[model samples]
Target chain A: MKVLAPIAAHEELEMLAAAGAEELYCGIVPREWLERYTGAVWLNRRSPKGGSLDSYAELKRLVDDAHKLHLPVFITLNSPYYTAEQIPLVLELAHKLSDEIGVDALIVTDINLLMRLSQEKLACELHVSSVAAVLNTEAIRFLLNFGPSRIILPRSVTLAEIATITRDVGQQVEIEVFMLNDGCAFEEGFCSTTHHHTVGAFCTSLSEMDTQFEWAGKSFTTRRQNWLRRNLTDYREWVWYVNGNGCGVTPKGLPYGPCGLCAVPDLQRMGVASLKIVGREASPFKKLASVKMVRDIVNRTRAGVPKLHVIERAKQLRESPEHCAAGFMCYYKVDESA
Target chain B: MEWSLHIGGAHELASELWLSRFVEADRSQLTQPWSELAGRLLVTEFGDIRFTHCAFGNEFCEHLIPSVSALQTALTAAQQQQLSFTLLTPYVSNEGIAALRPLFERLAGNGGGEVVFNDWGVLNLLRRDFPTLIPIQGRLLNKSLRDPRVTPMYATAPAPSSALNVLQRSNLDCESYAALLTGLGVQTVETDNLPQGNDLSFAQYGLRIATYAPFGFISTSRICMAAGLHYRKADKFQPGAPCRHECQTHLLEYSYTNSPFGNRDQKFFLKGNSYFYAHTESMLHALFAQIRAGQIARLTWQPRLPMTVAH
Candidate 1:
């Protein structure tokens, strides 16, 4: 199985390669305010609502650089609900990426667009975004019917569930298991902390819109900045739930528990095609070290090369005493005309 | 709310039968036999009245003319000293909205509380063509806005009035039994039956069902539309081994009950009880009678139609 790590800068990519990342998926958003709050005020400027995929020169450079080390690149054009107008722009961008950038695959969720791509033979492979909510092996099969090479499973899936799916559907398509720094259940794929609560806009339709939502009295607008502020310079959680105790269906970042640092061995046993790390705000140094730790463990574990020693290495590598659990990006279904 | 009497005739009450408590249970407590004493429901607990089309899948632009006529007739039939009708339009193309201009012309000189608007394009057009049509963002808009965290059923109303920009272009739809029935702060909610979370399918859940249609259908709409009454037991496949997939042509209509068992049983079923939707609608209409009974500043519709009784 190949392992992919999402990186922001070339520095991050270099660190990922040193860490043994199979592939690198990156985004085009400023990272500072992100450190502050995933608050509505902070928007991905390059891909505003219905925004086009960022140009390939920089992304291509990253991909080209990764290729030197034999690492592949899967470009993310995943967001939700492109208006009827954005469709042409998206198809055009898909063409450029497939024909020009030579990306390994384009991770996507939009059905109408996917259906269109099913007809045209494109260059890059298509993997359903986890936000498209492929939960079971049956779902993977249905998605495969559309002819995708891979299916990004939902973040909320348990290791047992992953294994079951891989057992049933693994031969049909590659399964991508998340490795590190997924904030919310899945699609909220960023590093989450206790100090500042970061809520991912799983619902991508309105996420890009410079709009606010009015529901049940308190309105949460995407564009309007929230006045409340807090600081979380310190991070600690084992004070809450016992290991394997509250691991079932708890949202990340509660007062009592450390967020889920999950079952990598089980994922390996399940035999996923790729081990992906969902990186959002991890410092390049931490990301590098994290990648190195995970890659070594995966290589050792998969090859039957010193398994316990790799576990020991993982324990020491996962500083902050917090384990790193990986999962898929959350996708929502708000296609313009689903 | 528990009531003393059952009311309404067959055709009208068929939709209300799902509210078995009000229609069926209330029958035991009534002094009058559904005809005479039922009339008191109008004077007691009803407010502004609304008449809507029998909601089915995808009413196209072409259906608007007949829909308008149906709207008028249903409105006239529903008229009483207190009852005023709300013309419910289906989601149609902008051309569908344009067609309403003539209908609006007929209703203009004689105006009342606005015609509920759901389509954004229609909302834009109606503001110019028939300002009186009173554009309200229907729950359909909210359905399209698939924010799982924010359900129309949760808080019971659209956020607060402050969250809304309520210019003339805005009237809200607080659908009856909407996710949050009382949460949405719409001027009024059109209800057939209280929304049961069962068989609820939306664009989001659609993907979940692609692999298992019966479960998908159940998660979407509880009642089967075609059979009119019955629940599906298992998720059905599109074709292949079962039934030769013959039902694929009219999948939406017949697919609701397409069982994986194939023809093993004379009555294999899955996903929804469309008849339940029917019974629930009538049940809701009677409940609407109780809900609409109190308002002072609106036209109300509560008189039972003699022609449509549940047989």
Candidate 2:
């Protein structure tokens, strides 16, 4: 399996690559990250030297090392917006990712932007991202037609469904499933508006702390389909002080808490081209330990059997500093669904 | 009977020729290139052809749309005089819709042609803004398929694949698609590059995001997604230049499909499996065929058939 090591820093990338990492996925660089952060004074886009550091240079260095080691890289492109003002910049970066930097694929979320890339720009592989809400066959079929090189499967699937999906789709296109640490309540494809606040340019991920989404009157929210029946075309089901009613999205099925309940066996049966372990939030030691656990299971899966033991693994990883356990989201699923 | 043919004349071919300019810097290639492409388009008698007013990406929102007079000039000079063509714009943003009024006057200056829009807000907005111009909500607002889960992600031994479940499940998606059409009073739902077997037009009415795949033969398409697009509009010129390629992606690949091989597979879907968008287009052809032929096998929910009766 192509093991995608989710690293927090460039230094960690080398460590993971040495740990048999085949691919890497990372967040926006600090320099770039500071600029778009939504809050006026904090993230100055006009900053002359970019940010406090030229992280892109560091990023390029990491990319060079990965390329030398024969590891592919994917940059995260998940964000929320309507007009698609992101295309030109996206295209330019993709060009660099291919021509100079050489990142293997881009983990993207938008369709209109993706279509233009496939048609007009970019020579790199388009790996389907987790945020695209591609959960079902029709959704998969819809994305498949676009000719993505691989699909990063949603975190909501069970071992059985992944097997069925793998059986139907095949391993050639490459499937990157989240093997450890991270699962959300929202449908992976349709719901994102999180992580950044629009109206301002400084509400970066760091600033937007202590926030969680929940329904306004979920109990009162009608269970009926298409809440806007009287005005069928109108998607304004709920009046929002900010955006439209989830902008055609409903609040149902959003898990209320932790992710990672079915982590163990899930890693074993997914059969994706890569078994990715989401890091970032986890402690460094836990990050290393989590990678080791998943890598071991994946290596064993080649023997035609799957490995799992979420409860024990979670217990074992508790002593480490980066303690967001692999099954961190697991308990939350049960609590919310219950 | 031969299925509906989307034949492009000299005018329809111009958009592609304009796009081809970016690929090849040589000015000569753009000038007479379609002489060959148009010949290829005309001999194949088409039922309808489409000429969108805007470039496919969001960048075109700020630019001035080429005037209808310019479009008319192109049409007049084009080879095929008898062939019919139409208009489709994905979103029809406020800036674009305003530019469209004058452009449409030019497209219809020759006494007649149709203009169909894709965005829902644009449809409602246009009904208020451009009451005279014909509108067709691009599949963006009224999708060909939508997957609303009623059962667990995984079912007991042997159930329909999640890909097929949206089709089998409560037909909620079909109902939504048909109903929206009835309410909006649209002319047609635009779809391209559909699945081989199922036709969006006839298979069953459903709405979902579909992507375009110009290469490789894929009948199944991107049937699943990983997650959803989570946007945070912070800035365009943030400290570090935006990753040009990251901006190109309409939605996050990891966030959406389980099968985002878009760059490799060259496919995608907007709300759902944009990867298998070709299937959605194919489905549109089937629906158009059955609807035009006046035979809808399963009108489980036709929204409002009476309203759709063109005659």
Question: Which ranges in model 1 have alpha carbons more than 4 Å from their true place?
Answer: A28-55, A185-262, A305-312, A320-338, B1-311
Fraction of native A-B contacts kept, per candidate: 0.00, 0.00
Candidate 2: tens digits of C-alpha lDDT, residues A1-338:
66677765667766776666677776543444335532211111122222122366777887788788888777665432212223456566667766676667777665544554576556678877765544433345446556788877665444444666677675556766765554333333432112212211111111222211111211223432223122211211101101111211113321122223234345444456777766454445555655665555545445644234444444343333122332222311221211
Chain B, candidate 2: TM-score: 0.44
Assess the local accuracy of residue B129 in candidate 2 as a C-alpha lDDT between 0 and 100: 48
Off by over 4 Å in 2: A29-54, A81-84, A197-270, A281-283, A303-338, B1-311
Task: Report the backbone clash tally of model 2.
Answer: 168
User: For chain B alone, what TM-score does every candidate structure achieve against the true structure?
Assistant: 0.37, 0.44
Question: Per-residue lDDT tens digits of candidate 1, residues A89-122?
Answer: 5677678777887777877765445665676789
For TM-score, the strongest prediction is 1
